[model samples]
Target chain A: MPQTGRSGCPINLTLEQLGDRWSLIVIRDVMFGNRRSYGELLAQSEEGIASNILADRLKRLTASGLLTRRPDPKHRQKGIYSLTEAAIQLVPLLAHMGAWGRRHTRSSKELSVRAELLEKGGAPLWNAFMDELRHLHLGAPRPARSVFGELQAAYEKALARRARYAQD
Target chain B: MPQTGRSGCPINLTLEQLGDRWSLIVIRDVMFGNRRSYGELLAQSEEGIASNILADRLKRLTASGLLTRRPDPKHRQKGIYSLTEAAIQLVPLLAHMGAWGRRHTRSSKELSVRAELLEKGGAPLWNAFMDELRHLHLGAPRPARSVFGELQAAYEKALARRARYAQD
Candidate 1:
């Protein structure tokens, strides 16, 4: 298919394909939160993505080969969304974006905890997380390490620290 | 200033602030092309951003601390734009995005050369480039090594290669 981009510049093409406010968020929800259905994505999103926008982004992402859609075997009316390998590979990019935001923006401690750990863990952790994601979303063999568990533990620890600080 | 991001999640915050098709492109032009004036940005842009959108994004970027705008000493009626520390920090994110695009999307050889070099050069090159940008835009002392020159040279070589291929 002819690429529908403003220009052939790789960055511009990427932006054209997934540069909107909602596309990567949809991918993030699917990849990180394991929200496989539209309803799950709509209800669980922290960013309050509108249903219409979510619908549009899902179609776009699926068309762009970043996501795959199939009828839910458990419920035919609902479609299940899963990340393509392309979307799964975006872990590093999202990790870097999260790290940058944590440093430069006024982010919430709880919300930014994952980004901090990702930054601290660097690419090795990112690769491990991607492996876990593949197992979850693509039926791949699970990696030996649980980077997700490590990240969650770190976040919980950070939250506990914040709570102690609040009391002090 | 209170951040205007949609959520405290670092990725969501970054996207809300700059997930549009044009915001990062504008920053990229200012950072890479050294387009310091509005007319220069508008006229030299490959994507043909509408004037109203450019104006609005410039205002938003300035407000969000990604860009600084100043009265032009050469022209009283016009203004000069420069990347702030926040924007200079976006180099890695943009680079990764570019690299991903080159891998997954149809991309131009000449346009993707910078991203290729960035992937090859990694953090040391990014740090050097950021140091150079700080000196150029923020009055910091210039680094002895010119990462910018190296990137420019790579782009020029890629363009020449593309030209030779086109002729053949």
Candidate 2:
């Protein structure tokens, strides 16, 4: 399909396809948070994504081939959203973005934990995480290394640290 | 200053700062296209940015610390804009973004040449380019290698190829 974006510069095209305030956020949820259902995305939204905006972004992302929606087998009426290969490939970009934010923005310790790990771990970590995502979302064989576990463990540690600090 | 964005997730924070449609485009022009002044940016806008939007984004980017503006020595009435360390560091993210678009989106060959080279050259090229940007925008000493020359040459070659293809 022809890109109807403002320009054909690859960055502009990428932005045209996915530059909204919430599109990447939704993909982040799918890729990292493992939130698949519309309800889960809305309820678990750390950014407090409004339901209408979430619904619209879901539709747009699905149309743009970043996501695919299928009927939740357990509930025929509910749909599970999965990231497409396009969105799956966004790991490095997301890593860099997170790294920039960690350095520049004011973020909660628990939230910045993932960005810190991703930056420190670099490409090997990003690739391993991508492999694990392929296993989870694309049904690829599970990789022996679970970078996801590593990242999640770090985040949990930060959360525990915050709890202790709070009690103090 | 505290982040006014919805959440502190690094990705979300980065997006909150730079996620708008035109913010990065303006930066791209300044970084890659060498369009610094308001006139240069407005006149060379690839996406044909509206005058008001360009004006607004320039102010926002300047206010957000991604860009700095100063009265032009040549023309005191017109201000020259330069990228800050924060914006200069966006090279990797922009590179990944462009690479993804080249793989996934429909783009004109000429405009995508830089993205193609960036993907092929990888981090080394990005670092060289960032060094070049620092020299140009931040008054750093010029680097030994000029990835900008390589990227611009590739784009020119592609533009000529497109012209020849059209003539055929």
Tell me how many residue pairs clash in candidate 1. Answer: 0
Q: Cα deviation in Å at residue A152, candidate 1?
A: 2.6
Expressed as tens digits, the lDDT of each residue in B110-167 for candidate 2 is: 8999888988898888899999999999999999999888888989988899899999
Model number with the top lDDT: 2
Q: lDDT (CA) for every model shown?
A: 0.86, 0.88
TM-score, model 2, chain B versus true chain B: 0.95
lDDT tens digits, residues A27-108, model 2?
Answer: 9998888899999999999989999999999998999898899999999999999888888899999999999998778867
Predicted structure 2: clash tally: 0
What TM-score should be assigned to candidate 1?
Answer: 0.93
Q: What's the lDDT for residue B84 in model 2?
A: 94
lDDT of 1 by residue, A1-168 (tens): 224677888888988888777888898788767789999999998888899999888887888899999998889999999888899888889988999889887789888888888888887888889999898889999899988777778778988999999999
Give each model a TM-score: 0.93, 0.96
Runs of candidate 1 exceeding 4 Å displacement: A1-3, A157-168, B1-5
Error of 1 at A72 (Å): 2.2
User: Who wins the TM-score comparison?
Assistant: 2
